[model samples]
Target chain A: MLDAKGLMVFYENMLALNNVNILCKENQIVGVFGANSAGKSTLMYTLSGIMEDIKKKEEMAGGERITVSGKIQYKGIDITKLRPSERARRGLILCPERRRIFKESSVLENLRIGGYLASPAQANKTLDYVFKLFPALVKLKKRVGGFLSGGEQQMLAIGRALMAQPKLLLLDEPLLGLSPLMQAILIRATKVIRDEQQISILVTEQYARPVLPIVDHAFILENGAAVMEGSRDELLNNPDVRGAYFGV
Target chain B: MEILIYGTINSIALALMALGFALVYGISRIPNFAHGAIYVVAGFITWTFLKVVGLGYFLSALIAILVTGILGALIYRFMLIRVRGMAISEIIASYAIGLAILEGLRWGGFKGMTYTLPVFIAGSVTLGGVPVDIHRLLLIGIGVAVIALLWLFTHYTRIGLALRGMAQDERAALMLGIDSDRMALLATAFGSMLAGLAAIVLLPLGNIVVEAGYNVLILAIAVCIVGGLGSWMGAVLAAFLIGFAQILTVVYLGSHYQMVVALLAIIFTLIMRPSGLFGRQKELEERV
Candidate 1:
């Protein structure tokens, strides 16, 4: 389980995220729905500890001052100050926005790199699971990641994140720019991964319809603020939520 | 026939000099300007081990390589880590380290041409009616072996894959639990070892003088600039291109013009293909 409370992020005078709270219980799928510039990616970065890295880089370059204040509890540990790599070592893996897969590496190589923290035996086992979860990747093993189609790249990205053996997976816009069919396949696979692997997932997206079926609890983020939070059924009954997120 | 044999040998030597520079830059994007200084230091360490400690040549070389590796790691940990992500600072910091090491050695009485490493094997062999020393032949063998071993290491091992991933995308690698600092430190250490290896193999041909460090640094930079900065294959190919060009210049234009070939190659590559032969900038632009 992971709990993030009172998270606020400021990029100079601009507020990227404002006093937002999000949580995910063990083996649960939590959906965060937001539109453009809704701080979805910022939230993901904050939770995954990548914001700390960004802040450091910005400080080194004397660029925009990034100020982050939050308290993140991951499985009972205070992890707000942890570096991304350290967080990753504790199984807090982030499949970042835009599918950020290693473009120059082959699909297998990407997966192997993802297995950096795993023991040899664990890596082997997870590699098998990843291949099984994304069967389309098996044939594209040797193909370069940059050359892959958007759907294939997203699959590889998720597969790569899985190779890291995540206890809590944070997926940022996994369905972006994908066809409806591909989205369906990925959403189905996401559920299957949760059920089989018993991994908690915190997935963020602009469009929530395709992902609505799987997520048990969901939050609606509007302009860096969490506007609503409820169970899937509770959210579905709200006409405003349906109209804004599901376009129903 | 002479040109062909000598050209290949020259190319291999150039590759040996540039591989470490390319590797550290490739993985960590840190242009270790101290590469050449590390080479000279390795040579001196080997000399000390063999002459002062009365150790065997092999043992001395091995310990020297290890010490230089640690030296490289220390450089990264203590200095490069602070200036990281700032390109100008990174270059200045590393170059300063190089200058200090080279000048420090000179000040410490490590100058002059009397210091030399013994050749692994003696005598010369005739090939195609052209005579070549056994050591040069052995250098070629070691060069090829190093290349093959590096290829296998990067392609097959877990750490190698992680390093490649780090080279391609640091944030993505971090998401997968590969620590950037640790990887950078490893790269600097391994790169230093490669530099030391090159020194151990090549120093037998000449004296280990501090001035050689400056020449090696320039040559290494020329190769990296001509090749693409971070591409391993590009560095190797550029080494051959520059190497053969250097040898050809030496044969046709006189030996003194050899350095001119490398300098000219660097200028030409910058003018015609700023990204070098296999630079990633073009690909990145295309992707964008």
Candidate 2:
């Protein structure tokens, strides 16, 4: 239940995303595939309202200005310019890349913050559900996040986001720097969340093969534009996509 | 006998002072250099309202704590939270506020002068064969009582737990729906209030000069470090250690290098533990 129309984003002077649009159905998983410098993260940042675009001529022309013009709607609520915390409270949670975990904090403490948007009762329920999906998190509750291994950290990061009880979860490269087994484990958790809670997700990935099988729809982005968009089967059969993206 | 009593009293009061500084540092994650200034002004306020304005000591302490709280909120809302920039800017703002208070109070007649206590609690009592000033014994008792209360507040209160949580992870705290700005304000005020209590107790012991703030400030820093930066018990324990050290050193080695020795203790702790006695090992990455 999310819609993006005519989304444009630029980082300072560099154009990172242009004229992008996508729709996410309820309970569906949408995968966006792109290479490095393909403006994937830029689009996500603009949609998430973390970056702001300056409108002055000096900034827009040549200065380091992230100029963004977009209309991002979640469940018909216009959140194109809402603050990050407000957006989170409205259930648009980000499981950011590079694992933005509070390393010095304990695992349970990290999860407790995820419930920022939920009611006290809802927070308790969300914590229980997250613990179930990532059972390893429960045993290591007292341990600091910095001390946890890579796989455990990733799981904790994802679990922390889930505590927010988001309506449309945004995942930025969940597979980055993780082993195949860890990747599979996280990928499985994504499916479980969608199945059990009916929450939609928009996930961006650098590699397609590992993520696309579970995705209901796929968008192949090239250079700052959406070059391809189709259902899972259509994307799988497209010769151009297979050659350019899959290298098959 | 006097030396022993002096050392015990000074140890407790000094610990209380350091606890205030450590509390702000631990929760706000900023040194809040203005904290000493806050303590200084709290002393002035206590004297002003208690003596000049003819209010009783108890009432003056109450108003001083409230004013300190408001001062903290002003720093947080107008300066710390709203004026967004690096932490250096925030610290500069706090220092500026402290300077402004110092200037304002001086302009209003303080003039780099010292304060006098109208009431005095003079007399002596012997503790286990040691003769001690009654007021100082009261100071030690007050210190212990305040420490117990603060320990309970931090351990049992919901907001206190949230503050501890915020200190560890601000974003996570925000995610948990914790009101961070409010928490910061409360912690800042509560911390300064402890310094005010210490100041209140220290009255009648001597005159409180405008420049007298840093002497206690230095010891508080030492206590925080030896106690482990934000560790409550650590600050308390370190306070006692530093207090006893100051007493023992002054008696044996003379009083000249007491400040120097305290500074050395801070340096040694930094080189050795870096995290303070109870402070957690900080993460390598700068917070996002």
Candidate 3:
């Protein structure tokens, strides 16, 4: 299980996330829906330790400029202050929104490099599984990553993350700019990965409609706050959420 | 025929000099302007060692190379790393070091005297009816041999491959868990050693002075710009091209304008081919 409680984040002096709490059960797909500039990227970057500004509610300093803060517990261990690579070692992997792929390198080479922070023996075992999960990537393994289409790049990104044998994969805005066909492919693939690998996934998305059915639970964020969080069915049925977020 | 043979030897020597700086730039991503100081320092130090301490020529050269390596490492870890990512600042830093080193060498030990080295060989070689100093010819041979070895190292060795990877993309290299600092130290040592070797060889043929590197430094930098960073093959080719051009210029227009032509060629190459003739193509890889 993953739990984040009483988390506060500040950058300089401004608050991005304030006193937020979350719980994700093992092997579950959790989604966070938010508008642009709603502090989604900051939240994800904080979780990954790339942007380090955590705060306890007691320590909040009229906070408005700081980034991510809060207790993020994974498997009962507090990972709030862990280094990014240390987090990866403990199976808290991030597919980073832009998918930092090494261009001029082949798809397989990029994947192998991503697995660098892992043990070679384990990475090799997981490499076969990653290929099986994203067979499209397997065919393009020898091709340079820079030449891949957006969808293919996204597949390679997630495939690289999975190559690390992640227990909880944090994806930031996975479907933000992808085409409808690509979005569908990603959703279907993400579902299969969760079920087959028994890995938990927390994906952020701007369009909730497409992401609604696949995820078990969700939190709707607006203006840097989690307005509501519940089972997917509840969020689907809520009139306020539908009117405000889904534009129903 | 006389001009052609002399020009070839001169070109090869200048090419070897440029390789010294190119090696450091290719690995560390810092345009090391202070490398001229290495050439001048090694030359002066070797002259002093063999003349004052009565050491053999080769032994003095070895000592100078070892000292230069230590200095190179010190400059890297203490100075270059501290001010990297600020290109303008780094340029200023290297120039300051160069100016300080040049001036320091003048006052402290050399005392503005024109120091001459014992000739490595007395005879001249008559090649194609052109008589050239045998020692100068020997320096040209050594330059080619060193360039060949450097080529083999980059194309085949593990550390050389890592240096290339770092030069192309430092962040990506780090993502691969390569400790770039260690690689950098090794590169500085290797580059300084090569430069020192060139200095030791060239010192015997030319007058040794505190500011000895000024002429050769410009030649080397031009070679690097023309060769392209991160490309050893490019360096070798550019070195020869610039070298021969310098000699030919001296033959036709005299040595007074040799540097002017090299600079003009460098500027022309910069405008015409920013990546140089053999430079690696920039990969527009997305990094978001």
Candidate 4:
């Protein structure tokens, strides 16, 4: 389980995330819904400790001044100050937005790269599990990552994350630019991964209709704040939530 | 037949010289300007170990390579780590380190044409009715083996896979628990070892002079620039192109014009295609 309290991120004079609190219980699929520029990705980055890397790079380049204030606890350990790789070592893996797969590498290479943290046997087992979860990847083993279709790339991205043997997986915009059918397949696979692997998932999305039915608990983010948090049925009953996110 | 054989040898030699520079740049985006210094220093170290310390050639070469690798890692840890992400600072710091080492060696009395490594083997062989030294043939064999080994290592080994991941996407690699700093350190060390490998093999062909340090740096940069800064395959291809051109210039225009070929290749590549032949970053961007 992961607990984050009073998360605030500032980019220069602009507020990217403001006083947001989120939690993920063990083996649960938690969804964070938000529209464009709603701090969805920022929250994910902050929680996964990638914001620290961005902050360092920006500081080095004399670019934008990014200030992040948050206390994140993963399995009873304070991890807000930990580096991204350290956080990943503790099983907090983020499958970033835009499917940042190694483009020049082959599909198998991407998956192997993702297995950097795994033991040899664990990597082998996960390799099997990944290929089993996304059968399309098996045939595209030799194909370069960039050449894959959007859906395939997304699958490879998720598969790559799985290779890290994560306890909690962060899915950022996994359905972006994906077709309805592909979305359904991915969503189904997400659920199957949770049930089989018993890994907690914190998935973020702009549109909530497709993802709503699968999430155990969901938080609706608006303008960098968590405006609503409820169980699946509780959120579905809320008229405002239905109107804004479900397009009702 | 002479041209063909010598051209292949020259090409592989150029590839050997540039591989280290290309690798360090490719993985960490740190233009290791100390590459030539490492090469020259390794040659000197090998000479010291062999001549002064009275060690065997093989042991001296191995020890020299290990020392060079540590030196490179220390340079990264002490100097390059601070200036990382700033391109100009990175270049200045590394080139400064290179200058200090090369000049320091020159000042330290590590000079003269007498300092030379013996050839790995003695005598020449008749290949296509042309006499080629056994050492040159051995260099070609080692070069090919090194490339093949590197290919296998990157594809099959865990650390190698992690390095390849970091080369493509640093942040993404971080997300998967591949430490960027650790990978960079590994890259620098491995690159230094490669430079040492090149030195031990090629320095035997000529004297280990301080001037060769500056010349090696220029030649390495030219090959890397013409090949594509971070592309290993591009480096090999560009090496062949530039290497053969250099050989042709040496045969026709005189030996003095050889260096001009590499310089010309760099300038031509810059004017025609700034990204070089195998610069996948820009091409990948256009694709996506």
Count backbone overlaps in model 3. 14
Per-residue lDDT tens digits for candidate 3, residues A143-224, read 9777888888898888877766788888888886899998998999899989988999999988798888999999977777
Stretches of candidate 1 exceeding 4 Å from the true structure: none
Judged by DockQ cut-offs, the docking class of candidate 2 is incorrect
Candidate 4 lDDT score relative to the true structure: 0.94
Name the DockQ score for candidate 3.
0.13
What fraction of the reference interface contacts is present in each model, in order? Answer: 0.76, 0.19, 0.11, 0.89
Query: Model 1 over residues B38-119: C-alpha lDDT tens digits?
Result: 9999999999999999999999999999999999999999999999999999999999999999999999999898799999
Q: What is candidate 1's CA lDDT for residue B123? A: 99
Q: Please give, for residues A138-221, the per-residue lDDT of candidate 2 as tens digits.
A: 899999788888888889888878887888888888888889999999999999999999888899998888888899998888
TM of chain B vs. native, candidate 4: 0.99
TM-score of every model?
0.99, 0.82, 0.71, 0.99
Local distance difference test, candidate 3: 0.76
Give the Å shift of residue A136 in candidate 1: 1.0
Best by DockQ: 4
**Tens-place lDDT digits, model 4, residues A1-248:** 99999999999989999999999999999999999999999999999999998998899899999999979999999998998999999999999999899999999999999999999999999999999999989999999988999999999999999999999999999999999999999999999999999999999999999998999999989899999999999999999998999898
Better of 2 and 4 by DockQ: 4
| lDDT of candidate 1 over A1-248, digit per residue (tens) | 99999999999989989999998999999999999999999999999988888888899899999999989999999998888999999999999999888888789988998888989999999999999999999999999888889999999999999989999999999999999999999999999999999999999999989998999999999999999999999999999998998887
